[model samples]
Target: MEGDLERNNHILGDRWESMMSGHMTRIANEKGLDAQNFRCADCTSPIGIFYGAPRLCWYTGEYYCQNCHLMEENMIPARIIHNWDFRKHKVSKRTMVYLTQQWRDPCIQMDEVNPSGYRYIDELKKLLPLRLQLATLEPYLQTCRMLTPELLSTRLKGLHHMLGNPHIYSPHDLCLVRDGLLYNAINKLVQFGTKHVRQCALCTAKGFVCEICGKDEIIFAFDDMTSQCQQCKGVFHKRCFADRCPRCERRHNRNTPL
Candidate 1:
């Protein structure tokens, strides 16, 4: 019976849980509950990094522990990206402010359901790299806020109709609940580029039309003997990688993470 119980627990282990918010009481609120401590209730170790979990508090915007809170939506982080029309080049700087301020909102409109809830290899398969998505979305976020407030309202309505169930909506539904709500906020900002523009990621130099020019002038993205990372197909002059690997490529072993 003990072995059977262990097997059952392991099977249940992989499920996503979203209720760990303990109903959004402050960190102090759930203290000493024993039933809802932040540690792994099973192994009793610290799991306090507090990352993505499906269970979120509708009241407080907080990520919960998944291990102790099984059978609920596993909150994995996903950064939402959208088009923004802001013309400023401060993608990196603006993103920092937007994120800090936006992190406090309620998860109002998103859903944490497995995009294909019952079919994927893991229930939390929709989980994406938080930093990766955030980085990608930063370039487009600042200008999305320029959208007329009406469009934002209409978009929310469309989402509500698309995913909201009769009784409960997952915390993921809220712009606040998602990893890069700022990305989405900026996605809705006004956008202006057209006819395609390619710029040097390193120097932000613009208007290079040829790969050779890109290779010789910019000094990266060329696959010279010294400039290759196993992760990204980015080829660079040897000096580029030795100085700093371009974002496109980095060394990764079979077991290594990208």
Candidate 2:
């Protein structure tokens, strides 16, 4: 009976420690942690309370000794993900290194992680449409044989990845977005791509004239005023195509072998 009691006590102690450790790791600010619980989270060193308490890392909300902390400052990923806060805060050496390495990785899913960021952040709201526009214009720009790599490089600068996939956003990209710098860059890129598509002869040849309206105006699939048929890939003016694509019906009739 005594042996079983001792084993249970050990199990309970381990569980309590694990819970506390998780809670400490997730604490966002110093206020969440007790001053009496000060210890180096990394090295498990007990810092002297009278001589000097361990430094608090803003990122992990845990205290660390001087050897572990190194007084490094970095932007907290949790703060950025939750509050859209871009301010740099004092962090531990390990946190600083981890965030620096993750800066360029497209791992943050803004919509899934913090949907409110788009609704609250005016810059993010503005940037979304610009990215969508660039995404739409990408196919036209990519398929055009006349477009030079130098011209595209000059226009797109460092945003070529956005054309392929606009949903993914890196921490570095988010920082620029928060600063209102990326918005202007994406806007300019969309404008440049749109102008090229509309003016270039090869690109214009790929545009479709609205079959319903019978207008000579060239319209691309990306145009907001146009709608596309899922079956035949026919493009028509949104107003004219209302419920169905007449071109699809006509094509079906022709292919029926009457």
C-alpha TM-scores of all predictions: 0.22, 0.73
lDDT minimum window of 10 residues, candidate 1: 189-198
Candidate 2 structure quality by residue, lDDT tens digits, 187-214: 7787788888999999998889998879
List of clashing residue pairs for candidate 2: none
Give candidate 1 regions above 4 Å deviation: 1-123, 127-131, 143-258
* Candidate 1 local lDDT, 137-170, one digit each (tens): 2332223444344754564443322222311223
Stretches of candidate 2 above 4 Å error? 1-39, 48-51, 227-235, 241-258
**Candidate 2 structure lDDT:** 0.76
Q: What is the C-alpha lDDT of each candidate?
A: 0.32, 0.76
Taking every candidate in turn, the Cα RMSD to the unseen true structure, in Å, is: 19.0, 7.8
